[model samples]
Each structure stands twice: as C-alpha cells, then as structure tokens.
Target chain A: MSRKFNFCAGPAALPEAVLKQARDEMLDWQGKGLSVMEMSHRSDEFVSIANKAEADLRDLLKIPANYKVLFMQGGASSQFAMVPLNLGGKGGTANYINTGIWGKKAIQEAERYMPVHLAGSSAEVNGLSRVPRQFEIQTSTDAAYLHYTSNETIGGLEFDYLPTSDVPLVCDMSSDILSVPTDINQFGLIYAGAQKNIGPAGLTLVIVRDDLLDQAKAEIPTMFSYKVCAENASMYNTPPTFALYLSGLVFDWLKNDVGGLEKMADINQRKAAKLYAAIDANDFYSNPVALENRSIMNVPFRLADASLDKLFLAKADDAGLLNLAGHRSVGGMRASIYNAVPEAAVDALIEFMNDFAKTRG
Target chain B: MSRKFNFCAGPAALPEAVLKQARDEMLDWQGKGLSVMEMSHRSDEFVSIANKAEADLRDLLKIPANYKVLFMQGGASSQFAMVPLNLGGKGGTANYINTGIWGKKAIQEAERYMPVHLAGSSAEVNGLSRVPRQFEIQTSTDAAYLHYTSNETIGGLEFDYLPTSDVPLVCDMSSDILSVPTDINQFGLIYAGAQKNIGPAGLTLVIVRDDLLDQAKAEIPTMFSYKVCAENASMYNTPPTFALYLSGLVFDWLKNDVGGLEKMADINQRKAAKLYAAIDANDFYSNPVALENRSIMNVPFRLADASLDKLFLAKADDAGLLNLAGHRSVGGMRASIYNAVPEAAVDALIEFMNDFAKTRG
Candidate 1:
C-alpha cells in the first residue's frame, strides 16, 4: 500500500522505517514466539529493549549520568501537574515564562498547586508570534523552578535562547524534542510526549536531574512521584510496553538511519527554510512569526484569501498531503514537519503549496 | 514463524488473530496511508476507530446509559490514587477489603489521601489462598465507599461474591474485567488495566456512574478527574490512540470471534478447571488457593519437591510453554489462562505437567 504525508500537530507522524520494523516484529519480537506487547514488562526480552532505548536516547542527547530517564505514561499534560507537585512542595512560588498556549497550560496547571510568578511572557512582545527573550524573564527570589515550553506546537513559537535562573529550569519540549541537539545538563527537568518526535502517543519521555527526584510533595501520588518512578526504573506499573517498544525502534532509527540529532537538525533547518521561503516569496501566503523566533517543527501560514482555506486543505488531501490543518482554536494551515517527516514530504508540500497559490490565488 | 503458548500474568498472551491484524495494519491502517499510532486522536479516521471500540466495549459489557466509559492512561496503579482523590472529597473513611498484593497497594495509596478502614481481609480467613466472605466484611460506620479487588492477579484469588454496602461500591477489576459478564449497575465505578484481559498495558478502562463524576476533590489534577475526562470524551488530551485502537480490536474479537463473554467464560472455566484438577489429582503438585475462590485467570501451582521447580520451568520453555515461572514475590509456576490463552495451551501444559511428575516425582 502507498503511504501519505501526515502533519498532525501532536499525535503526529512517525518514521516509515520505524513503523516497518515494528510491523515486521509485531507478531514475534526477535523470534521470541510472542509479540512484545504480549510480554511482561519484567521479562528479560522487554528489559533489554527498555535498556537499549534509554541508552540510545542518552547517546543521542549526550545526557548526563546524573540524570534519570523515565519512560512514563499520561503524556506531557500529566507532567504539567507533576512538575509543580514535585518541585513546588517546599512553599516556593513557581516561576514561569508564558510563551504560547502550551506554556500558558503549564502555568495554569502549576497554579492549581502553588503560587506562580510570571517571569516572562510572549504577550509582552507581539502576542503568540514571538517568544519572550532571556533578558525579559524575571524569576522570583523564592522561585521553586523556572518552567517554560521550549516550542509551542499550536502557535508555532519557539525559544531561540534558553532562559537561565537561580532556580531549577524545567521545560515542556513536546513538539521539538528530537529534532535538534539538546544539552541535557542545562535543565533540571525536560519532558516530551512521544507522539511528535519520539515515537507514538501513549509514552512520555522524562529526563530529570537525580537531585530533583526527592523534591516531591508529601501528598504526591506514587505514580506521579519522579523518585518512585525513577527508583523502579519507570516500571512501578505495567508501562505502555508496545508504545515503549515502538519508541525504542524510533530511538534506533534516530541513531542509525537519521545519523543522530545533528544530522536531523540540518535536514530540519533545510526543510523549514525552503517552506518559509516559499511562503514569503508570494503575497498569496504569509506567516506572521518573527524570523529569529519561528519554529522549524510547526510552521503556521494563512492564505491571502480566507475563502480558499477549505479548498486548500481539500486539494492537499487529494494530493495525499494529510493533516495540514492548523489548531482548531486558531483557524488556518499548519505544516508540522517533525523529524520523522522526510524532507521529500516537505518538498512535495512546498510544490503543492506553490501550485495551489498559482491556480487558486 | 511458529507461535508459542505464553502464560505470563501480564502483559500476558494476546489472541494470535489480534496480533496478526495489528501486524498487517501497522503501516497502513485501513488503507489510510499511516499507522493508527501516527494519526491524531482528533482526526476523523482515528475518532471512528475510537468510537467503534467504545461501542463494542459497551455492547460486550452491556454498560448502562448512566455510566461514562473513560479510556485513560497510567494503568490500574494510577487508579489506586484516583479512586480516593476523586471519591473521598467529603472526608469519610474509605472502606477497603484487602485480599492480596494489589489490594494492599491500593489501600496504601488510598491512605495517603484519606482515612482507610479495613472492612475485611483474606488474612482473616487463612492467608491470601482464600477470599474473605461477604458476610465476614464489616464496613465502618463512617464509610464513604467500599473498595474491593474483584480478582487479585498476584495471589490467584478471585472474590466468590460481591459484597453489599450502603455506601457506593468501587471495584478494581484489573485482572478479571472482561473474563465474564456482570451487572454494571451494582457498582459506582469499575477500573481495569488493559494488559490482562482487555488488550495491552498502556490503556486503562474506567466505567464510572455519571452522578459520581462531580464528586472529585478540588485538588484533583485535571487528568485524574472523571468529570473532565467524560466531558472531553477522554480526549482532554491525546488519550493513548494506538492502545485504544488495539483495545477496540480486542473488543471486536470478544464480540465477533468469541461470540461474547458467555462463550469466553465457558472456555476459560474449562481451561482453569482442567489445570486445577491436574494439580489436585497428583500429590507431586499442589495449589493452596480455595476451590471456590480460585482465579480462573491465573493458576499458580507448586511442586511437592521444590528442588524440581527450575528444571520444570526449563523443560516447559524447551517445549514452547513460555513464562511459566510465577511472579518474583511468590516463586512457583503460574499458567495464566486469560481469554486469549487457547484451550489447547492448557492441554499442552497439563500434558507437560503429568510428564514431568511421572519422571521427576
């Protein structure tokens, strides 16, 4: 069967190679006589799969030994509450930099548990189009941790510079995690939902400093406690085994097929550049984000005429380019060219975009 | 490739037909040109898969209109905390009947949120071998709700009867949810991890009465709120799309292939009965669990000569009977005959058991 290009924003595309490998091994994982999904989490075969995935991830990111990698469930939204419940238990206000919808969500969830200080905000500049600069961030003296969304998937805003604070730095890196090289040592905690750049939707990847593990509130649920999860190697409960197995295949793809994150970033930059250049070349399409702060992962653009929006999406679907619609909250077009999205898909999308603009402009 | 009989407690054996379908559709789901894992939970294609799965599950269980089925992440372990946090807002002591390891863990987690009164326990009878009778249970005068483990996976204990209570009833049916039909109107809420009898490990199924949805504590996380999840149709976030898809397939298998739970129970009962009879017939092998309270899902038996345990497991493995070893907490041999484990597998296990006893006894 022929495949189509998918650009779903969150539960987005996965590498074709990874999906192929998973398909081949779905019935009997490595000749083990049963599918990986059918194996116990504590089984020797699954443990090896789990360990290798974590190792490949550490190698790709150059993650510090002092950091613990947690393969968790409940997505990044769970981490929104976990970040505060774990870090804000000591009676300190959480410092947050509100960049877009995702960052605002983290702030809102954190506010449920403790007092929150708005260290910075994208609204101070040009609404959701631009990310707040590092210098604009103001941390409270009693800050528990400074939290921000590294890339907002919906609004297409990204941080060009990492904000520093005396408090621990926490980030929600859901949309842009494996698309680039990241310094794991710079953050106290970093979490990403696996659907976008990692693997699938159910599994969540958490990289947190070991020291921060014990900072959870006394009332923390055992499942949400990083220390408990880390201690049990994220097997406090039956992990999403199939999701973890698929994610391991993704980690393998990232390391071997894609040649690591540096190569990934180069390809991502080129793809984003060509697409943005096409958008800016004609008045038929326009993207409002600042050039320096634009997100390479999620590129949101609007047609010169609002009436062509439905037609553009329908034609895109006809051309086998799928899920290009923007967030429901904001009506437009968005192309989430994640790491797994081949550059060929981007080229095809750009070609389709130019053709659509010429004929329908 | 040949398939082997897997007796793992969980993530246990899945129907070969289910795994085959999953393998066949891994890359291109229903000719949609992308894996179910890649499709957005909000996409029409994915939504159709989700809705059909829910409908099939409701049909299989004969769920009532007053109950809302929530497809959530974080497994049954997360429900250990959620049950208390959601239902204990008014501050009455939560009544629990502890039977085995899973039940004890649930009680410990519940204690962190509210006062817990042990209404009854298996230890009161003998140990974990016999379930505490309904008449023996003594609910507290200030009981907010009564919680019980319908079937404890670890100890091979299945409750013989449902305990009656004036307060709301909450049941953790993690191990025996879909094995047999039951009256859903008897309980306030029922939650189960999907790995054992449902589908896989990542998804948790919650069927909560609509009236109980609004009783959550104000401090509950949005992800943990039944009201919020039901309102969003369990799409408050991504909601584990692939796991949900796979679970739907399992429901399809139950309804279409197995001809509903009555047929499934017929097969499961025969499988368990034959295995337990073999153990009872021979002095070389024995199971401590009571006859009436024995779990039809997991059957744990031990050799009279404990020294032969390792050899028996090895010989069973060599014969393609895999994962015969019991849980690490309790050392023995366990043959989990969940719905997916064919009757042929049990015949093979019995043959192997008798052969081993003849030679090694």
Candidate 2:
C-alpha cells in the first residue's frame, strides 16, 4: 500500500517504520503467542513493555531521576482538570498564561477547581500572533503553580523562550514535547497527548516532579490523582496497552532510527525553515504568526486569493499531501510537521505549493 | 506463526479474525494511504469509522434510540469517578450493591464524590460466592441510583438477574457485556471497558439514557461530563481513534462472523458449562462461586493442593494455554474465556486440565 504525507493535527501521522513494525507484530508479539492487545496489563510481558516505553522516553528527554513519567489515558484535555486538581490543593490561586485556544481551554477547565489568575496573555496582540514575553508574565502572590501551553497546536503560535515563574512550572506540551531537548528539572509537571509527536490517540504522557505528587486535593477523584498513578507505575488501571506498545515503538524509532531529540530537532528546524521560506517567497501565500513565535511543529498560512483556498487544498490532496486544512475554528491552511513527518514530506509540500502558486497565482 | 490460547481477564484476547484484519490494514486502511491511527479524528474517514463502530455496537446490544453511546478513555476505573460525578449531582445518597472486588472499588470511588449507601453486600455470604438477589437490594430512602458490577472479573462472580430500583440503575458490564444478549431498557446506563469483550484497552464504552445526561455535578471536570460528551458526540476532544476503529472491526465480526448475540450467548453458555463440568468432575480443581453466580466469561478455580498452583500454571504455559494464572489479589487460576476466546480454545484448556488432574491427582 502507498503511504501519503498526512499532516492532520492531533491523531496526526505516525512514523512509517513504527507502523511497519507494529503490523509485523500485530498477531504475535515477539513470538509470545498473542497480540500485545491480548496480554494482561499485570502480566510480566506487558509490564516489561510498559517499563521499556517509559525508560526509552526518559532517555530521549534526559528526564531527571526524581520525575515520574506516567502513561495515562484521557489525553491532555483531562490534564487541564488534573493539573489544577492535583496542584491547586495548596490553598493558593493558580496562574495561567493565555496564548491561544488550548491555553484558554486549560484556564477554563482549571477555573472549575480553583481560582485562576491570568498572569500573561497574547489576547492584546492581534490574532495571537505571538506569546507574552518571559519578563512580561506576572505570577500571582499566592500562586500555587504557573501553567502555560508550550506550543499552541491550532493557532501555530509557540513560545520562543521559556517563561520563568516562582511557583512550579507546568506546561501543556501536547504538540511539541520531544521535538526538542528540555531541562525537565525546570518544570513541576509536563504532559502531552500522544496523538501528535508521540504515538496515537488515547495515551497521554505525563512527566511530573516527585515533590509535586503529594499536593493533590483531598477531594480529587482517585483516578485524577497523579500520585496514585505514579505509585501504581501508571497501571492504577488497565492502560491503553496497544497504544502504549505502539508508542514504545515510536520511542525506539526516535532514539535509534532518528538518533534522539537533538537530531530530530535539527531535522525539524530544517523542515520548518524550508516550508516557511517557501511561504515567504510567494506572494500567493502568507503566514500570520510573527517570525520569532512561529511554531516549528505547526505552520499555518493563508492563500493571498482566499477564493483559491478550496482549489489549493484539492490540488494538495491529489498530490498525496493529505489533511492540509486548518482547524475548523481557524479556517485557513495548517501544516503540522511533527517529528514523525519526514523532511521529504515537507519537500513534497513545498514543491506542490510552488506549482500551485505558479499555475493558479 | 502459530497462535495460542490467551485468557487474560481484561486487556484480554481478541477475535483472531479481527487481529488479522487489523494487521492487514495497519499501514493503509481501505487504500486511504494512511493508517487508521494516523487519520484525524475530525476527518470524514475516521468519523465514519467511529460512527459505524457505535452503530454496530448499538445494533448488537439492541440499544434503544433514547440512549447516547460514548467512546471514552481511562477505562472503568475512570468511570468509577465519572459515574458518581455524573449521576450524584441530584442531592440524594447513591446506593451501591457490593458483590465483588470491582463493585467495592466502584463504591469506594463514589464515596469520594457523595454519600454512598450500601444497599446489598455479598460480604456476609463469605468469599463473594454469590450476588445479592433483587429483593435483598434495599435502595436508600432518597436513593439517587442503584449501581452494581454485572460481572466481576477478579472474583469470577456475575449477577444472574437484574437489580430493580425506583431510580436509575447503573451497571458496569466491563467483562461480560457482549458475551450475552440483554434488555438495554432495564438500566438507565451501562458502561464497559473494551479490552475484555469489545476490543482493546484504551477505549471505554458508555451507553447513557438521554434523560440522565444533564445530572452531572457542576464541579465535575469537563472531561468527566457525560452531557458534554453526548452533546459533542463523544468528540469534545480528540478520541482514541485507532482503538475505536479496531473495536468497530470487532463489532462487525460479532455481527457477521459469529452472527448476533443470541448465537454468541448459546456458544458462551456451552463453553462455560463444559469448563465448569470439567472442574466439578475433578477433585483437583474446585470453583468457589455459587453455580448460578459463576461468571460465564471468567472461570476462576483453585487447586486441591495449593502447592500444585505453580506447577499447574507452568504446564499450562508449556502447553500453549497462556495467562491461566488468576488475579494476584485472589491468587489461584482464572481462565477468562471472553467472547473472542473460541470454543476450541476452551476445549484445549479442558483437555489440558483433565490430563493434568489425572497425571498429578
């Protein structure tokens, strides 16, 4: 079967090699006589799989020894509530930096559990073109923790620099985790829905510092408590076994095949640079986000002739570049070039865009 | 590659046909040039897959038009909190019937949200050998709802009859949901974790009556709200798209390959009966649960001599009968013959058990 360059945001494209390996092992995992999906979560076979996935991820991220990496379900949306429920019990208001749709949603969900203070925001800037600078952010006097979206998936806005906070730093890195190396010790908790840079939907990757685990509200649901999940090694219940297994394959691909996050970041920068260069060179296309804040993972652009938008997407699909349409809330074009997306895929997209601009500009 | 019998309780065996189909389509689903895992949840392709799976499940269970089916994440453990958070907002004590481990866990989670009254309990019966009869279940004076585990995976106990109440009746049918046909009209809501009888570990299936959707507590997390989920058609956020796709294939297999639940139920009864008869005839093996209460899907047994337990498990593994060891909490042998576990697998297991008894008795 022919593979296409898929650019859909969240539940996005997986690495072709990982999918091939998964396919080969679907019926009988390592001659275990059963699919990974069929194994008991408590079984030695599955526990090893779970541990290896976490270990490989830790190695890739160079995560500190004291942090617990939890393989959970319910996506990053669940973490919006979980973050506040787990961290907001310290009798202080939580601070949030509103940058885009995802950041706003996280604030709205957190408001249900604790008092939320908007310490920093991009709303003052037209169209959320950039993020609030680190110096501009103001942590609340009684801030339990400071939370922000590392990269806004839909808006294609990203923080070029990390924001500092006196309270522990928490981030919703749903779209950008593992795309670059980071100092895990700088954050209290960081979570990403696996659908984007990691593996598939259903599996959420949560990395939280050991010290922050015990601060959960007493009234929080047991399942919502990060400490419980950490204590159980993320098997407080049956985790998405197949999803975890597939993600483990992805972690392996990242480490061995792509040569870790440094190499991945280099490739990502080059890929995004080429695409952005193509956009800037053409009068037919224009990107809205400021140069400094442009996300390396997601690039959103508009055709100069709005009438040609439908034709552009149609031609791109015909050229085997699928899911180029932007999110419904923001109607334009967004190419989410996650770690799985190869530079060749970006090359093909650029070639197609150039041809489309030449023929239809 | 040779396939063997796998009897994992949850995250259990799936139909061989379903696995083969999944393997074949892992890279390119329906010539769509992308894996089901790679597709956007909001795309037409994945949406159709989700819709068809829900439709097929509704058809299999004969679910009425008044119910909304939700494909959620975080398993039944998450549901333990969600059930109370969603149903306990009406300001009445929630009544729970405690029969086995799963039921007790459900009650414990509910107690964190609101006042929970134990309507009926099998603790008095000793070792949870039987379920409380309908007449024994006494709903509270101001009962919000009656909740029970229809099939306890760990204890191998199942409710032979429905528990009736004036308020909404909720059931966690995690293990035995698709094994037998039932009247969906009897319960206000029924939920299942897909790993057992449905598909995989990452997806949770919820069927809630339309009228009960609005009862969620205001303080509940948005991700925990059944009303919001139903309104968004279970896509308030990115769903576990690949898991949902695989489950749809399973539903299709259940409908087309095995016929409807009537035929499946007949086969399931026969499979359980033969295994139970084998256990009864051999003095070496003893099933603890009452005959009527014994679970059709999960058959838990113990060795006459406790020392033989390890040896029995070893031989079972050597003979290609895998995962026969019981839950760690109970510490015996459990053969979870889910709907996907073929009758031939059961026959092989019986032969192995009979031979083991004769040689070592």
Best by DockQ: 2
For model 1, how does the per-residue alpha-carbon lDDT over A1-361 read when each residue is reduced to its tens digit? Answer: 8899998897888888888888898888888899999999999999999999999999999999999999999999999999999987778999999988888888899999999999998853453367777788889989999999999898888888888888899999999998899988899999999999988889999999998987788878899999899999999989999999889989999999989999999999999999999999989998878888889999999999989999999999999999999999998999999998899999999999999989989
Write one digit per residue (lDDT tens) for candidate 2, span B1-361: 8899998887988999999999999999999999999998988998899999989999999999999999998899999999989998888998999988899999999998889999998743554388888788888899888999999898899889988888999999999998999899999999999999999999999999999988888889899899999999999999998889999999999999999999999999999999999999998989999888999999999999889899999999999999999899999999999999999999999999999988987
| Top lDDT prediction, candidate number | 2
Off by more than 4 A, model 1: A124-128, B124-128
Which docking class does model 1 fall in? high
RMSD of each: 1.2, 1.2
Global Cα lDDT for candidate 2: 0.92
Checking candidate 1 for backbone clashes, the offending pairs are none
TM-score, one value per model: 0.99, 0.99
Predicted complexes: DockQ each: 0.86, 0.88
